[model samples]
Target: MAKIVVLGAGLGGVIAAFEIRKSVRPEDDVTVINENAFYQFVPSNPWVLVGWRDREDIIVDLIKPMKKRHIELVVGKAERVEPDQKRVRLTDGREIGYDYLVIATGPELAFNEIEGLGPKGFTQSVCHIDHAVQAHTAFEAFCQDPGPVIVGAVQGASCFGPAYETLMIIETELRRRRIRDRVPMTYVTSEPYIGHLGLDGVGDTKSLLESELRERHIKWITNARVIRAAPGMMTVEELAEDGSVKQLHELPMKFSMMLPAFRGVDAVRDIEGLSNPRGFILTDKHQRNPKFPEIFGIGVCIAIPPIGKTPVPVGVPKTGFMIESMVTATAENLGQILRGEAPSHEATWNAICLADFGDKGVAFVAQPQIPPRNVNWSGSGGWVHTAKVGFEKYFIGKVKAGKSETFYENAVLGLIKTKKIKAH
Candidate 1:
């Protein structure tokens, strides 16, 4: 009997455990290890910050789902990974062994890399559900006395969609409150351009986003490195194409939400040959670690190199579609291994994103998730906001039902049909 373990219970981990449970034989054991007992829909975090969603609205108690699926849940913090021993050491003096392991522990937010940044400091964040709640509190206070607002991602940050979503969402809220004019908003990003999105401009995102910001009277600074974040003030250094300091700007802001860079979690990071220098898991096409074939990795914790050299470091985003592909591929490959057959599945790594503003949003698809793709498409309208709302419900329901349906694939089919109409 194979003992399969999935570490972390985020989007990738939860879905991986469910999918693998379906794929494996009845006698094969499946278990999930997560630091949290509940699952929060991360994509809804921006809405939470704007008071559109409460904590309970997005959270699902994992206990019920795991029990229903018959998948064991080990709710505890992991201290370290002993790859050689094929075991995981818990913080509370316990070791869990596994025949095959899937590591989906998402990125460790690198907020400390900047001075006076993150929730513990001056700025707010929507990376986690708790952070989103705190950001909502700060948003309410900022609305009372509106001033300049800064929203964007810092250097080495991979996930750019949330930053953009939060930026536009905040703008939409400020306008709804009729205090938009009282607050000057600026988008500061490490991307070379307004809509680079760490994928080098999917379709016409540069034009789409730039036009949106202009229409909303929002300012922007690309290739920006936020050096420090003091209360009501931000120190930013704009970088030249040659990576030199071009200009230093002291941007004033009463409220801010800056997306920090991501690195692998402490448990698996520093494991010899398991993680890269930046602590992201090293995996091949099958999402299987080359040095340790029994271990697979998916989602934000996996290492995906930047598309190309940029003025400032901008890591590639592992979008929902891409992570789903990884989970499917990993499950298929593990099933093959359990059956005494060689694994052959490989994730497509496609990128499909829905970046919703309050009333409108943008949707983009990158076939291969890299540059020079077959189906590089992006579109925007009020429909995207509706679509995103549907997506949030669909995904959270899947978590409750223990289903790993190809959510993005199904959504993208309709998007492609729409793209075809536009093409004609």
Candidate 2:
């Protein structure tokens, strides 16, 4: 039996592990390693920040469920990946060897790249539950005072949806708290426009997002390159459409939440020839690390160039379905490897995004996550928000129950193409 080690227990990692277990024989040893035993529902983080949801509501301990799946769970931070040795070194001084490795360590919060911007300094981030907890605390304190609020994603940063979601949720929370009049809100972003969203404005995203912001009376500044951030101010350089830097503007705020640029988690960061300059794992269409055939990466951990650039530059979005598609492809490849067959990687864009706007939300579905898709569609309503919540609930339950087949079927459903299945 081949020993397999899966790093991280995030959405991608957990899904990959479950699907892999389902495909491989029962006697094969499959192990999952992560710093935390619980799996966090990242999409629900904004709600948690606004007091709409508690920390406990979004956190799930993986030990009980993983044990039921007969998967070994190692709860500790992975310190190093000695790929040449085919082993992973843990913080507790344990080494786990594997015939194959799945790198799903996810992204690292590089707030330090911006001067005076981080969890300890000027702003708050909803990237993690702990950060959101701190943000909620700071937000409550800010509410008592009532002042200007600045929220946006930093330059060279992808994952723009969360930033937009947080801004709207905060605005909604303030209105619900009866403090809307006390807060002057501004939505500043690295994107050239309101709806670039890393995919160069999906479907009607540009018009839809802009209309929502205008309706909410929220001021906006786009194509902003944040140079510095402090307790009361942020300095940014506006960019011209030709990719030239424009004048720098210093803006002040009572509370700020800026999404930092994302990089690959540490395990692959310093590895030679494995990751790019930005610290994202360089993978082929199959999500396999180009230099290391036996190693694969999924989700935000892998490197994908921007579809296009605006004034501030837009990065790619790795929505749940997209990541699951990568995971599904990886699992299938691993199954082939276990059978002594050559493996091939093939991933096509199939994305579904639900962007919540407080009381209501927008739902988008695109076949090729980039531009010029086959199934390009979008809708807006309160029911979409309800659907998002319902999907989250159903997803978490299914994951915890280790229902891999059900999850895979639900993920691809009608999207998987039979023609795409070709042997290597």
Q: Which candidate is the best by lDDT?
A: 1
- TM-score, cand. 1: 0.98
**RMSD (CA, angstroms), candidate 2:** 3.9
Instruction: Say which candidate scores most in TM-score.
Output: 1
Candidate 1 wrong stretches, greater than 4 Å: 418-424
Off by over 4 Å in 2: 405-424
Q: Evaluate model 1: give its lDDT.
A: 0.93
Q: Lowest summed-lDDT stretch of 10 residues in model 1?
A: 415-424
Tell me the lDDT of model 2 at 75.
Answer: 90
Cα TM-score per model:
0.98, 0.94
In the predicted model 2, the residue pairs found to clash are: 286-345
lDDT for 300 in candidate 2 is 86
C-alpha lDDT values of all predictions? 0.93, 0.83
lDDT, candidate 2, 286-370, per-residue tens: 7788788889888888888888546665678788878888888899888888888877757775777877867998766677787
